[model samples]
Target: MPDSNTKDQIIKSMLNTAFYKSAGETSLANIAEGVNIKKASIYNHFNSREHLIEETCRSCKEYIEQISFIPSDIDSVSKKYPAETVLKGIVDRYFKMHEKQPLIQIYTFIQSQKYFTPEVMDIIQAQKTALISQTEKVLLSLIQNEKINLDSNDVHSTAMWFCSAINDMLSNYLLERKKDMLPFPEKNADKMANAKSDDAAIEKINAYIEKFAELLK
Candidate 1:
């Protein structure tokens, strides 16, 4: 087995490349070159490029989970934090973590390759399911405690909506969407303004989520 240190070094190389480069474009030779190892040495740690991508993706998921601390189970997180505070914190982490970490860059890279490989699609779908599920769990808690109320009986749908809205807003910020791109320049201008308001987290999310938050109250 490759020593743990060498193995870690290899994975780190994958992550750095994963953000800026597509999975299809990321060659093991390039990774080895970056790591100061022979091209053949990559096979010593991972069986193939696909295997390396999978391993790198695993680390990506772990990095997100560890840094965000959004638990899979609701009870693991303390309820003392109000729903607004907790939800805002998670949303803040989603935006700020992407700023401070490689999650979005790597995620965007892999997503750009969805047509090139099934493995990338699988990772994307699994992560989306996990995110929706986690959001549902938290929304359930919020509903139980009377933090937010929904018109729909389906928590799953509303949970998906809540998460989707936040994601759309965040994506707009990342893509730098602006009034010029839309037919309604005024509305688009307002949206662009909202996306940048409040240091790029709170107000943007509110523009997407406040209606739902109002439902909570």
Candidate 2:
């Protein structure tokens, strides 16, 4: 087996290209070249390009988990504040996480492509299960404590919808901004006003949170 350090190096290199460089399929051969080994060497570590993509995704998830701690205020809101407060807090935290971690955004885009293969769908489902389960735990606590109105029927769906919507927003926002075309003159002022990394995340999350809140009314 290849050493752990060597595997990590390969993964690190892939992430740098995929996220920082915004590489498409063309960059794969170049990345493979950097491995300085036969193409078969990579196959020994990962089954295919998709598998490599998934590993890169897992790396991004781990990166988010490491740095995406929720605020104490938000945690407390889940216990003590209204449902709206809790929802907004959750949305805010998610947006901030996306803003800070381009790798997470990259992985999310990869995950969305799983429709092309059953294997990818399976992997994506597992990842979603883990994320939703964690989210459910928090929701459960809030519901049990009567801080939020969540119960059986739509709670899980709402949780998933929020997750999907947030990630989709991040993916699109990044893709659009990174495209080569310049903004129209009329849109330039608006774009510049909201040009900060955090702005798009905030805008998306807040808008979605409002939509989620409306569902209750």
Candidate 3:
């Protein structure tokens, strides 16, 4: 069995891989150079490149789970805060998570590459599915409480739309980095408080909020 020190080094090596290279192209040599170890030494800790990357992504997911992604209980949050406030907070958290783990952006960008290793694709799907499931749950709670109303008889579709909007914006933010991409966010969203100066972003986000509001009634 690998000692804790060896395991930690392997993880660090994998993170460097995510930041600098995609799974399709990453090799034992690449990791060895990043970890400052000989290529054969990596096999002492992990069996293969796939094993290393899978472990790395799993570690990333575990770390994210502890990052205070959300605190409020969905039903209670909807009851206590306006729908807009709660929804905006969801969007804000999404961005904040990206900010905290900028490597995840690079990781995701690489994962979206034309050729994804099966292990890498599994990691991506697991994260995406988990978020979609959580979003659907909160959305159902909000809808049952009449916090956000819509004519769609399909709760799943409506919930997906809300979640997808945030995901789309995030993808655009990472891939494009366009200043005028999405809304700049509002005053209450402390994470993006500086966005007030960007009128164009604000206008776009407000329009997004207004569209959501219209969907309510």
Top lDDT: which candidate number?
1
* lDDT (CA) per prediction: 0.64, 0.57, 0.60
lDDT of 3 by residue, 119-147 (tens): 55665566666667676776677777788
Per-residue lDDT of model 1, residues 92-175, tens digit only: 666655543355455565566678656667776766677787777777777676666654368888778787777677667554
Would you list the clashing residue pairs of candidate 2?
Answer: none
2 against 3, candidate with superior lDDT: 3
Q: How are the candidates ranked when ordered by TM-score, highest leading?
A: 3, 1, 2
Kindly give the stretch of ten consecutive residues in candidate 3 with the minimal lDDT sum: 178-187
Once fitted onto the true fold, the runs of candidate 2 whose alpha carbons sit more than 4 angstroms away are 20-29, 32-76, 100-102, 105-109, 112-118, 176-195, 198-201, 214-217
Q: Residue 137 in model 2: shift from native, Å?
A: 2.8
Report the alpha-carbon TM-score of model 1 versus the true structure: 0.69
lDDT of predicted model 1: 0.64
Query: Which candidate, 1 or 3, would have the higher TM-score against the true structure?
Result: 3
Which model scores highest in TM-score? 3
